[model samples]
Target: MTIRFRPSEPTDAAALLRVWRRAVDGTHHFLSAQDRVAIDPLVADYVGSTALRIAEKDGEVVAFMGVTGQNVDSLFIDPAAHGSGIGRSLVDEVARPTTVEVNEQNEGAVAFYKRLGFEVTSRSETDEDGRPYPLLHMRRD
Candidate 1:
């Protein structure tokens, strides 16, 4: 697949949100139904507000990531695009973040970050939104 990377535009919000939803559904089975419902609008808002790096394949958005300085705020790849290295490329080439947070229950995510040279530095009992899902704070070292 030929993947292109570019800065997100205002028109990309809907596609990015679609990628986010599909990715989360594919990987985040641990989330409670209620929590998922509550988080959807928040994610939609975040998609519109954050500046993102988008990965497009054949002119279709397949993944996107958000970064601020040395921190990776978000990364999501469409479920159909999983295992394609798109997420890895986004993290390594686009975000290149020194710090990231992963849901502790998402073992695949934790392992993915570890493979990218991140080590867990701490843990939190709740997510950034104070939800019950735990988070693993990681830093590249």
Candidate 2:
């Protein structure tokens, strides 16, 4: 399938949120149900307000990444589209972050970032929202 990359438009927020929910549900197994519920609104607000790079396949948004300066703040792909190199393409062509953070429990994500040249620099006992899940700070530079 051909993938198209572009900057996200205001109208893309809903699609991005759908991708986020699917991605998180598929990969974020360590999240508590309560935490997941609590974080949904936060994710919605962020998706609507942040600038993201989107990957579309067959005219459907299948992935998105948020980058700021040299940091990658978020990357989520539709669960149905995993293992398709969409995430890799987003990092290579759009995000290009020197730094990224991933949930420590998300082994797949850690491996994916490592394959892209990121190395763990530090760790946090809790996520940014003060959730119990730990986070690994990674950098490529």
Candidate 3:
């Protein structure tokens, strides 16, 4: 499959949300039931507010990344498309990304970032909203 990247449009919101939900449901084993409920609305808000550059394959949005300043605010790939190098392309497209926050419980994601030369620079005991899920602050080195 050939994957391409493009700036997201307003009409892409619904597809982006679907990709987010599918990705989180498939990978977020660490989120509690309550945290899951709380994060959905947060995700919805993010979908509308962030400028996303999306990865499309076969004319369908399969992944996306949100960058704000030097931070990678979000990167979610369709669960079915995991291992396809789309995420790597998104990161590469950024001239130089210095920081990213990752859920500490997601081993695959932690390893993925590490493979791309990011190392944990700090840790948070809870997520941004004070949820119990821990986070690792990573920096490209």
Candidate 4:
């Protein structure tokens, strides 16, 4: 599939949240079941407010990255499109050479970021919201 990216629009919020939830559910095995349940309803709100770039494949949003200045606040690929280069492409389109915080427990994501030339710059014992999930801060090399 030929993936392309465009700035997100107000109407894309719902679909973006769907893609985000799918990606999170598929990859966030470190999140407890209760965490998933608690987080689900917040997805739409977050997507609606973020400055995002949408990754489209065949005219459908297959992934998205939320960016602010040079920082990537969030990146999610539809579970159906995992391993299809969507995540990397979104990062390239929106936040290549940028900074990001990845969950340290998500080994695949850490490796993926490394493959894209991001190196660990620091780490935090809790997430931005003080969640228990540790975060690895990285910057492109």
**CA RMSD per model (angstroms):** 1.4, 1.3, 1.1, 1.7
**Which residue runs does candidate 4 get wrong by more than 4 Å?**
94-97
RMSD of 1: 1.4
| Candidate 1 TM-score to native | 0.94
| Candidate 4 colliding pairs | none
Q: Which stretch of 10 consecutive residues in model 1 shows the poorest summed lDDT?
A: 89-98
Tens digits of per-residue lDDT for model 1, 18-37? 99899999999999999989
For candidate 4, give the lDDT. 0.86
Steric clash count of candidate 4: 0
Q: Candidate order by TM-score, highest to lowest?
A: 2, 3, 1, 4
Give one digit per residue, the lDDT tens place, for model 2 in 10-88. 8998999999999999999999999999999998999899889999998999999999888888999998998899999
lDDT of each: 0.89, 0.91, 0.89, 0.86
Candidate 2 C-alpha error for residue 2, in Å: 1.7
Over 1-141, each residue of candidate 4 has an lDDT whose tens digit, in order, gives 577778898899989988988888888999988888888778888888776888898889989888887888888888788788878877776544689999999998999999999999999999877889999999984
Please tell me which predicted candidate would have the highest lDDT against the true structure.
2
| Model 3 weakest lDDT span, ten residues long | 89-98
| True-structure lDDT of candidate 3 | 0.89
Q: What's the TM-score of every candidate structure? A: 0.94, 0.95, 0.95, 0.90
